[model samples]
Target chain A: MTMKRLINDPYDVVEEMVEGYVKAHDRYVKMCDLEEAQGRVVVAKDAGTKDKVGVVIGGGSGHEPLFIGYVGENFADGVVIGNINTSPSPDPCYAAAKAVDNGKGVIYLYGNYAGDVMNFDMGAEKADEEDDIRVETVLVTDDVVSSENIPDRRGIAGDFFVFKAAGAKAAMGADLDAVVAAASKCNDNTRSMGVAMSSATLPSKGGPIFDMEDGDMEIGMGIHGEPGVRRGKIEPADAVIDEIMDPILKDLPYEAGDEVYVLVNSLGATPVLDLHICYRRVAQILEEKGIKVHRALVGPFACSMDMAGMSVTLCKLDDELKELLDYPCDTPYFTQVK
Target chain B: MTMKRLINDPYDVVEEMVEGYVKAHDRYVKMCDLEEAQGRVVVAKDAGTKDKVGVVIGGGSGHEPLFIGYVGENFADGVVIGNINTSPSPDPCYAAAKAVDNGKGVIYLYGNYAGDVMNFDMGAEKADEEDDIRVETVLVTDDVVSSENIPDRRGIAGDFFVFKAAGAKAAMGADLDAVVAAASKCNDNTRSMGVAMSSATLPSKGGPIFDMEDGDMEIGMGIHGEPGVRRGKIEPADAVIDEIMDPILKDLPYEAGDEVYVLVNSLGATPVLDLHICYRRVAQILEEKGIKVHRALVGPFACSMDMAGMSVTLCKLDDELKELLDYPCDTPYFTQVK
Candidate 1:
């Protein structure tokens, strides 16, 4: 047996690491004690106008700053952190929503995954039964790879849009229904695709979560290190960017004069230069196609630890969506907004 | 051997990683050339000047985002990255110093090690001769642990003050000489001590860079994973913090009403919660001592890869130092700077 072959159980590792993680990053977050705050995302009491709409988002634990990282801004009232991509308990979701719920109601946004849906849906039901709160769901299905082979694409990292739109609406004091509608619209208009030169080692195993050769990469791996659409020889950076973003552009059938918010996400390992180079080229490609790119983000947005690769997510937008996308935000991993 | 590593050639790993390092984190850094700029820190030419003084700090490679990571507004004008603390050749240091020599003249701040002192002094001499620049230097010697009760106290992880004081001064634009003087002052009042629960593993090694017992850690390990003053069984978190910070606080001869800047640096493997919990007790101790801590930073600044445990650095500051410490900065490994 390999030396690192963990002595304890794998199931126990997440909780242990998170315990360590929480201890380390606790400066940035407070794991909502389901027993205490119930469903609020912010550790403190509601400071944002409760009368305005509320945005809620979340998923598994591995995406440290994603769901939890986005909590401080106007984006989400709460983000339910669970196991790696596994949904949090209904209690936590319900508590987070209930905690943030104003007279206007709450909007729940998330990546498209069976577990998140089931658990979040349950949480919404629980919130409804306990308080006079209306909760709506908007699922982000951005992974073009999962969608290529499968009819329903697995949600990757495009949930960022839902948060932006919902947050903008909430910040504007829009009604809960309007917030939900805007979030849903953003989700529908968004699409993403990713390529990975290597798989992230499971935090527990400390080895490849999945397998690939030294020179090979999966052209459409999921955020959870899920299997991608195509596995082949590693290609040039330019070619890789094309491969990753082409489908995202096409699936949405983006056309000339259509404005969109583009994000080139590095899933760990891939350095900023590589990401910037890829994004610079990707932007040029879209520019050649006459796509009116309003804004762009290239960084480690949603990362799989130590995985060397990238994902391209584009959200087709108009004036309303663009404004929402430009809203301010502050979190552990992301910031700009007040 | 345990497999899975991030670098190729062990000898070239530091340099190779530095290449990707600058390329990856140049977002906040306005100007840096990895290929030509090798061997020294590269500062942005047009970084906004603060009315306060400016501080320039650096060290070796592999501790990325540390030396280079803090180069931004109110932080550092330039950082001179050494070859894993071996100190880059004098030319690169001069080049870097020139790039960051805001009209105020830049202070070359760093740890107080023989290699660093010799190289920086040489770099300073070169800067003076070639560019009509007068550079200042400060050596950080915070380790209370002697090399086995010897006279030599190798500079440990407390170089953080060099960055803070310089960053603060640079933000204020105190002109080069004043900033240099202030940074030197901060260093004079600064002291640090560290303990490693385990050894840091280099990415290329796929094994610990140094050996240690599962239940033991060196109480005064240096940033390069050098042996500490003493090795003993791992103790409770409270005890660990006391052991690390108590000596630092005492060595500074800290008194009541003295304001200070506190930095708890992780040698890598140490998780966040433990750092915070360490902070919790440490903060209380300082309060009881009647020290007015104007600013506090608790995170991984100078890391020893994934080495578990932490170090504490305390810089006794006056009002001028407080003003400098309040400056804003942005880099990859650090954020929430205001």
Candidate 2:
């Protein structure tokens, strides 16, 4: 198959994307100038100027608007950049900590992947050892089917809500511990599952990362072509969403009368029309279950580069989580106001 | 080739999408309840309350955020939706005008397509004859390569800018004529071109609307699979952008010292990662020409279902155009603040 990507080179994709991103959104963010960080860290233009706990989020590339697109006013203070599906180096991670640290402390938020955990922990240790600055970490494990153990579950679309809650808490002048608590609380309430029709075409690989027949789909697939629960011929929109929602609703046992924020996120290439078709089913199922939807976000919030799939994320909301999720924020990708 | 879409019966795609769209974005918009309109018209919750010219935009259904997503506070007051790649019947268009009119006249804005022209004109006549309400229109023709005559060009991604400027002008208490002029002025200043890597899969057809080989790309392809200037092997991002931008910049004769807004819009399935890569080259070209970029929007602002491609739009900014474009507005797909 043709690569079918608009890129100059495989190796330079990340750097070029960053350069274009900063230039396009210069008002909200800037490239981190720290020598140790270089092209691997993006800091909000107003980072280190506010008197609040710092909020940092990061992971592999290809998930646009996940880590980098969330950096701006009242959102993430800085983001550490990684290569496509690969973790960032330790130096840039440490540099992000130093850049966003406002003397109160810094909190790291990311998905629970082994490579990312190892790298971010090293960065936190470096910050503690060098500057004696306190840093806390919150691992978002919201993908319900990734593992049987709750803490071992992988993060997916739910990372958006977890980060939003944490960012808002920090922006509201909460200290490091409070911010971490908020993120953990949101993650605990959040659940996500996805159905993938095809794998993302990696720039380096020049084609799909994995192979599947054109008319088939994998239920509960991870973002990076990780193993899913079942693979079969693509079903109707309602049937596919029904199967995906079963695990999510069952894992949380989201009972009637619960208020939740709904996110129907495109993995990559799924059209907005299909997503809403899927969201229609989700809304029908939720209405049947008597779950009140506080707000619904439908689009490509978190995506795998050019992958054909989508994920549904629900963060069951309480009063506190509601306020935090609804807090005003100005980022390149997301903006809300009073 | 497999359709690879998640949808139910092909005939119900538009109705199902509208059901989910209004449900998901109920905070900003509500389904128009006129028995004549029903699911075909979406009106802002605050429409007809503000004493200003009613702004209504409409087109086919496949473009999601174009017609429906723009209906919200300080934006298009109502949207008339149609079937995929088809125009709305005159009823919804007339209903949209009736729904948004508040003593002040209504102005219809949309791409300049033959079917749209005939149907909207009929809607305007119906409103005048029945309700004694006046409605004016400014058809957008910004697709630079669509025709040699500027007035006959097709509108594509540049519709976003024209609608934004007119919406803000109307919200600022401009009369119908002023709003129409605003849209026309923005359209005159805007130019766009695109390349397509694949054709969008039509729900009704259960396959691509047109055939495109795996690795071939067509420069300046219209959103609905219209033929472009050239078809050949896909080139590097910079080279492809160079080809697309040449006609846009030269046709406008954009000169040094001109300030303009930039939009690198994804044509459905193109990833955000690839768009910024393309934007990097756009910036480079603008810098070389000494053109100043006021602001840049890079995303899937306008799409063609699941077609894999992108378009670049440039709207030259004067003091008036800049003020209008920068005006605060909140919609589901696009939002800005003072």
lDDT of 1 by residue, B1-338 (tens): 23223234456655444444444444555444434345455564454243333356776665544676667656677777766446666666766766666455557777666776787787778768877767877666667774433225665555666666666665654676666677767666777787776555554454667777766767877777776778876666667777777667767566688887777665653433245556665676787889866655655567654455677778788777776665555555554544
DockQ of each: 0.13, 0.83
Give candidate 1's root-mean-square deviation (CA, Å): 5.9
Error of 2 at A263 (Å): 0.2
In the range B1-338, model 2's lDDT, one tens digit per residue, is 68888899999999999999989999999988887685799999988889899999999988776778888888899999989999999989999999999989999999999999999999999999999989999999999889999889999989999999999999999888889888989999999999999999999999999999989999999999888999999889999999998999998767799999999999988989999999999999999999999999999888998889999999999999999999989998988985
True contacts kept of each: 0.01, 0.72
List runs of model 1 lying over 4 Å from the truth. A1-51, A83-85, A149-151, A160-165, A181-225, A229-326, B1-28, B32-41, B48-55, B81-86, B113-115, B142-161, B175-177, B185-223, B229-323, B330-338
lDDT of 2 at B16: 94
Candidate 1 per-residue C-alpha lDDT over A192-296 given as tens digits, one digit per residue, 9 for 90 to 100: 888887666564564567777866778888877788778877666667777777777777666689887878776654543345556666676887999876766
Candidate 1 docking DockQ: 0.13
- Chain B alone: TM-score in each candidate? 0.86, 0.99
Which regions of candidate 2 fall more than 4 Å away from where they truly are?
none
Error of 2 at B187 (Å): 0.4
